[model samples]
Target: MAYAEEYAPTTADPARIGYALVPLLDYFEGKTLMYVRGATCRGYVEWRTSMVRANHANARTEARRTRTVSSATARKELGVLSAAIGFWHREHGPLESVPVVTLPAKPEPKPDVLDRSEMARLLGGALGFYQLEWCDLETRQLHRTLKRDHSAINRHTARFIVIGRYTANRPGATMKLRWMPNTVGGWPDFKRELLYRKGSEVVESKKRQPSVRLGRAALAHFRRWKAIDDRAREDLARRTDGMATSFLCVVHWGGEPIKDIGKSFVTALDFAGLPRHYTPHVLRHTRVTWWVEAGLSLEEVADAAGMTTQMVEEVYWHRSPHFQKRAAEA
Candidate 1:
């Protein structure tokens, strides 16, 4: 892999190189062929983690690679450190021996889960938002020559809430939903598909080609939302010509993608009379619990949820009546 000549630093070239992390970033971000040494050789693990926590604050407002430096953060940071040091050691024998880097123990915390009734309230809230938006649009475009139906709805935030509940996808993953259609050559656009990645960049976590499938209810709602987007395309064609794609959760009554739906999510949860601690992630937990209660094995629930069986067992495993009955029968 060729390095970006302008950005890369070398030993012969003593240019301060800014944060001392500029060299290692090429390795982490897949730039290639940059020399990082000195403190890295002596205390790489600590330096790497500290650099991650301290360095990335100014550049981005959100979605930073190292915003939260937890133990898992340490694991990935140290993993990269190990890889870089190992590579350097093999290519050029500078250090006598590589110091051992210890990774943090895996965390096992109890998951907060939503019951089915709470799930319904969340979906109902989304549908209500859809209807509210549709009504607002109808009031604005009332004189326009179009047939009106009370049943017609186009909700985005609510769909996200409902889909997240059933798909067991991480909130971020579900937000990556697109509008791929079921053409003659292919299946329905939304299925358990690989999360899109660019170039040689890698997922730092074990997010191994995470896949999420919409259930029948979520699929139905998704189709309705697409229809709403299609109608929106015709009406707002001049403004949104190149803007349309398969983004499932769009801003209400428009073609814009909803990147940060935290406010809306919180609003929905609050409106549904749920706790603030019941974050979007709890949807996945709720799904896992439902799967276990429905008597699915840990492996089955893990595969469906795009997580490990160990994670499923550790955090979400609970013996429901069905599982207990089945156990007694056996």
Candidate 2:
């Protein structure tokens, strides 16, 4: 699987050559290849030769969908295999003496997604019994998990959910936001937040930046969070003037910053008996699908999500189950 994944994307037209095919060398790890029926000379070579030829042909066809580089990689692998087989046959005996073995094709990579209902259920579970407070918890708690208390747990969940839904931002972007709270200082007043990007730019670090925006619910949530934060600062200022840039979310022990929300997210998932595939990015995929299903124009969705319309049309269209129905209507 690793070998195929590593080598399959080299070509532009991979369908002619199946990149998903796994070589015996891959499964063996570092083990040497064996001639199981070295005793029987004639049948082995022909079978091995036929298998190798067929494998190459299949690989060539599949490589069409992939890049030229990936196809080249598969070809190079075949060359190595051919050279090795030739050496083995020459040293031992005729080509007829080797055994035949088939390789498995590499499976096409696809986005793993949860349907809207499943996503709602997953979020609900996280809100109550899982660990995170209901979605209404302070947005910052999503990243802070120093004490592992209920507040910390709920907060961490909310942060991740926000990352998943509003922006296609990676976990690192969330970390960046948490590290620089002032970036989001002006509640509702995004214009003043010069440190942060207007929309998806805050999250997208990819070479090609996408446009992203928060939905009404998401925007309202952040507005409320800002209000709470302002109130916390006011309370702190009243108590003492010596306080430093105290965080909006802090532990009872002291105003120390919480750390390790990502790990806690994983821990909460395990506690809930959910599949290991539950990552923050998966939620982003879910949101994109939701928008597409809701009948947003591809360009509109892309603008809202801070992405090129082409990208949304190409990569994410399949994630929505309603894509076919929508396309047919169009």
Candidate 3:
């Protein structure tokens, strides 16, 4: 399920790599006439075949060997040139499969966890600069950028990040803008309807949807963010109507929505000087780790993170090796 982001791992046959790349063939149909008139030769055909094969590196290698192009130069041209030729041939008939070449398995790397001190530094760094204020050195451009223009956009971003990090929802499930406004009403509303009801959280052929309540400290931080959002929206004519009709998150600011916020999380983390891996998903992992360290039952952490208890135990339970080692030392 996690591998869905990289590949369509759900396909019944994994051997036909880019089995999902099948549907994309339609897009190339428009380019058919241009390719048919272009260059045709042993070198071009070999290189072209490699491009269609799916493994990018192999395509480059085949192109270099066929054309006597240097290894370095071939890599640059492989994707662009090979793709052009491949699209041309797709209209005529099915291309032959790339020869399967298996390499010996390498040792898998162990997963690493941040120590408690490192975790403290990350959260501290994030909060220390949460209220964004921009300054221009040359002109003294001190302006309140958080004005009436983007209030709805900011609230939506806050809600998705808050709910996704707290709940560990998959991107598809959590990024759906329709469900967000109801969830952001906070824990009381969440607990009354979403939890205890079995199917309330579960989507068909999709993962269980858990309702996550923030910690006392996290809730305090969120309340501060909400206040800022409210002030930003206050200047608009008829602010109450704007709040009532629009979704908490919308595409008002530069045509961006809350769903686009995840990309910006990495840039924000870089600004805060935290490790690059400290993205929103890392916060999800950190929440689960803290619950386990605090002696919450595995089942509780799993439900909170929208996963099976076994997954939480398998992924994060070993994070605090010091606690286990302390028992033996004692």
Candidate 4:
């Protein structure tokens, strides 16, 4: 609790440490640091996996069952425990020795990418209306309606998709962007055609959030969004006697910032006739894949995607058209 609170304000994710620590606290209750060993860590992994799997088994739907917890989650939780112990030792120590926390092998990355046609379909779903079916309770009749009356159905999600696809930013970093510069979230500089993807005051995490230059299409969308937001703000100010204000780049119709778009994104996927397994993170993957396929140098792609060159070579170079071309020719 102390370590979590201490680093909460500085971390990009304020709740992650605390959330990971909850199960650890429950399991390690009354146990001293001396009791923490490789076997104990492995035991915790088993216990946590079984508990979550049991709950998942009780879920009534296939989708819910498929969301079972993996060993990766257990590894993260135990990593938090290890970090907490290390912090304690550094800050105030007299401990004889610290036990190493055992972790499961890292899982292989999922190979999922959206092709150009699929990308277009996804954007269409976000920007256009789709048919919705519902059963009328009184008449017991099935009805289909074109859901075009409400703008909230997919407007914010559309912006999210465009930004995510262009910037190759993580979903969280993309959603945290704003039009105006601030200390709490990233902001775009339209004149410079650059996007600062991390706040000035936020401490950098292992996952980098480097600035990226915007493409012409992305810049045009940002300009249009700014104009729309400015018009909306002015109208709201007049209606409320100059009391309305907003700074977020991605917003609903009324200018309120959207916290999460998972459900709406899934709806867009359904509308586009795509798989539900394609998550928002897949946008980043798609962008990286496209870059590699275009024969962009590893250094350039790594810098744009805020990843190390080694990672790009290891994980994405295989997608390149020129990959092993010399060897194949020989």
Candidate 5:
């Protein structure tokens, strides 16, 4: 718990560490390192997988459902536990041997990439308003309403989608982008047509966020968003006597940076006529898949997508036009 709280803020995805580690503390609180073994690890996995979690799909009704956890999730949690043990050993122990942390076999990758048409629909949905029609049972009349205006409340999500589609950044990195260089988050340099995905002070994590060049479409969106933000800032300053506003490129109408877009993203999925499985992370997969299908070299795609060439080949090479061409020809 102490280690997690100390390092969570420094991680690329603090929420992930927090979520994975907190529950682990409950199960392993009274236990020692010696208590961790193959059987114990398997027992932990079984216990975790048997537990039920809330179903967000029926959140409106405050419904509860029995959603069994996956081995992947258990593995991540145990991985954190393993890391904590290692840290303990390194910092304080000259003790005997380190215990081997048993982990489940890695699951096969199920990369779900969106097609161009689907991406277009998603972007359109993010930029448009919702149209709702329903019958008024009390009045016995049909009514139409336009609510949940994206331009007003969820415009930030549109910017997020555009940047994600072009840069293939993780959702957390996309949300951390600002208009100017800062010590905390990345910024876009419109003049140079590049995106510096991490601040100088930010440490690089396992998931890389290397700087990437911006495409014309992404640059145009950045410029337009900057102009709109500038105007909004000026208006706010005039009204509020120089009140400070967020420098983040993606923000609400009031210029506040959004902390989470889960609900808004779900609304976007619905508007795009996409299934629930289509998530924000799919934008990154879609961009990589598109680059592969377009005949971009593995190295180029890896660098642009902040991934290793090995990972590209392993997970996405099958999407490339040249994947098995030589074999097929032979």
Candidate 6:
């Protein structure tokens, strides 16, 4: 820092450590990291612990009483400070000292996910639900079974579950998906496969920008979903263009994105008899673990699962002989 100051007296330090924790906490809070400190640091653990304990009284379907703040949460919070310090150093040269953070340590385990059978049960259960309003059974010239085919919930949640598993995308990123035709969005070849852009919001903060490629099944589902929406409301579907739908998500009566799906996800999980702690994040871990176990390299798994190679090696399973033997190569 002295050297940097000496060399360029006009330059100011990129970061200032001589301050209370509130401002820094505020700055980091907006980002995706676990940026807990000050009041949040004091309250977060207690609040989470109380949430779990309270659930015990109302634990009808979920065994969420044991869920509480994890060591991983604390680790990430500390890492935020470390990252801030590093960023400052890179911008304004090295600092002699920075704030020292002590993080609580605990045993780290591999992330858990549903098994194949559980996945099937969840999908089947979601598909079984019938949305009477969306399905015009009385007016349609069809039988009972045939008219029940138009389930908006099934298209959204069940298909969402399927796409989430295959792509291993963050739920937010998956929901933000848009399908752009080749001719419209500077893509000259329409036959160049069904490509999905996860959009700038998803990639702006991320280091490795992703090119999301839809699998055959995903492509077919998207196509079918768009067709269904268009068939249901031909006028609204013509808003974007004569091309693909504006979003690759299931919409409501007015084509507005459903703000929350937690309730439906819970019902699906209960139907599948899965652990209550299982969430959409588990899909990422499952995909990474499955790929690693199936002999994909750490980098390969990271690319497919939207994670870093280090994360894949650390959070998935580290004891695999395949990863162990090729540690030097990575």
Name the best candidate (by lDDT): 4
List per-prediction Cα lDDT, in the order shown.
0.54, 0.48, 0.43, 0.82, 0.80, 0.52
Quick one: ranking by TM-score, best first? Answer: 5, 4, 6, 1, 2, 3
Q: Scored by Cα lDDT, where does model 4 land?
A: 0.82
Total clashes in model 4, counting residue pairs 3 or more apart in sequence or in different chains? 0
Model 1 lDDT, residue 235, Cα: 61
The ten-residue window of minimal lDDT in model 5 covers: 54-63
List per-candidate RMSD values in Å: 11.5, 16.2, 12.9, 5.2, 4.7, 11.0
**166-229, model 2: which lDDT tens digit per residue?**
5554343343343233432111234442223223222222323332455567666666666666
What shift in Å separates residue 140 of candidate 2 from its native position after superposition?
44
User: How many backbone clashes are present in model 5?
Assistant: 0
Question: What is the clash tally of candidate 2?
Answer: 57
Alpha-carbon error at 155 in model 5, in Å? Answer: 1.1
| Cα-based TM-score, every candidate | 0.57, 0.48, 0.45, 0.86, 0.87, 0.60
How would you encode candidate 3's per-residue C-alpha lDDT over 192-292 as one tens digit per residue? 33311122323222245555555565455445644554455554426555544332332123223343445455444543456564445565565567767
lDDT of 5 by residue, 62-110 (tens): 3335456788989989998887777667766754878888998888988
Which candidate number maximizes TM-score? Answer: 5
Model 5 whole-model lDDT (C-alpha atoms): 0.80
Worst 10 residues of 6 by lDDT: 181-190
lDDT tens digits by residue: candidate 4, 1-330: 667877666776666787788889999999988779888988998888765454457678986776656788899999889888887777778557987888888778666899998887787677666667899999999998755425535788888888888888888787778888877678889889999988889888777888999999999999899898888888888888866666456545458776677888888888776888788888999999999999999999999999999889888999999899999999
